[model samples]
Target chain A: DARVTQTPRHKVTEMGQEVTMRCQPILGHNTVFWYRQTMMQGLELLAYFRNRAPLDDSGMPKDRFSAEMPDATLATLKIQPSEPRDSAVYFCASGLVRGTGASSYNSPLHFGNGTRLTVT
Target chain B: DQQVKQNSPSLSVQEGRISILNCDYTNSMFDYFLWYKKYPAEGPTFLISISSIKDKNEDGRFTVFLNKSAKHLSLHIVPSQPGDSAVYFCAAIAYNNNDMRFGAGTRLTVKP
Candidate 1:
């Protein structure tokens, strides 16, 4: 029953407040991804970490959003001065990406239940 | 720009019938594609995937078809079940790239 775990399934805070979402990836998986889903934007990649190393985070807002993999199992996304525009369901996913030139480089990601954040 | 696109926002099918969900991508560099299913208040789950080198892939009751020339892909479910009703998302992976782009998604309703 191993799966990606996300905490604080729901959150509500006033504008300008800081919000932190945590994820515990499935053990042994080396890749972690963060995504934001909203009605207007659909689903978008916020960032991802591979081998505990940040890979592509260009999709994330540099000034307001930050994502980090402090350890292999723990990945975190933090939003400072959270705004109503940032309210959305944040998902964390993990997978074992095959090394380069492995025929298949992208491994299917297993996502967690997600954290629903509301900035009122 | 939307690299991946699910043109139809929603689709409906009667139970025990065939269900087809289509997705199109504009990125020629995309080398792999994946389909995911998501229910309300939950994360998207991986359903199936296919590599650019292959035209089709199948498992049990699900099958995926890819058309590289057209940059189109489709998911087919035979004997659609009530439980199969969910939002389906289309995703594409570029070569040697870890950043995956996703389509808006299509909501599928299977009537019993």
Candidate 2:
């Protein structure tokens, strides 16, 4: 079956280090989303892209976090000078919905296994 | 502020019994709701979803109920099995919005 693929299933980094996470969305999917899951905040949407263009990144920390969709198959979330609070599981999800208009009401997301990042 | 909330941190039930998990949302704009099951070290998997137009939706042993007036939703699993034990999350999507909000998960344990 097709699935969203993520790289570096686990990452361990020291504070102030730069961390990069990559995702390859399911083939033919046009929407990609990045999420972070932690015990305290639960699941939070950091950013999302539609048709290789970013629609929103308001949930991400503007100073240190950046998310990019360089191409249809590649999406990346990077944290420069990462902090301990950044430790969490990062998940990438893709859907067939090109937009949230009337025609895409039933579109559902398919998630990747996620990359567990631990910042010390 | 938390738009979606799952107050119960955990729940336990015996096998073959019914398990009920509740979720509440503050945003009336949220017209679509979904439930997801997650295991340790794995991503949350989509289980069931309900739209505000309908009050209830059922698939096999899983049933989801939505109360638009109260801005609440719930999931009920009948005849719970040992394999049903996992973390359950409630998610809400605003109408015509690409963003979806999620609540703190509730862990369920089904005992034999």
What DockQ do you compute for every candidate structure?
0.58, 0.61
Q: In model 1, what is the error at residue A25, expressed in angstroms?
A: 0.6
Q: lDDT score of model 2?
A: 0.90
- Clashes (N, CA, C under 3 Å) per candidate: 0, 0
Q: Estimate each model's TM-score.
A: 0.95, 0.97
Candidate 2 C-alpha lDDT tens digits along A46-99:
998889989889999999999999899999999999999999999999987744
**In candidate 1 chain A, what residue range of length 10 has the lowest lDDT sum?**
A98-107
Question: Which pairs in model 1 have colliding backbones?
Answer: none
Q: What C-alpha lDDT values do all the predictions have?
A: 0.90, 0.90
**Residue A41 in candidate 2 has what lDDT?**
66
Clashes of 2: 0
Tell me the tens digit of each residue's lDDT in model 1 across A1-120.
789999999999999999999999999998899999977556899898889989889889999999998888799999998999999999999988865322445457889999999999
Q: What is the CAPRI rating of model 1's predicted complex? A: medium
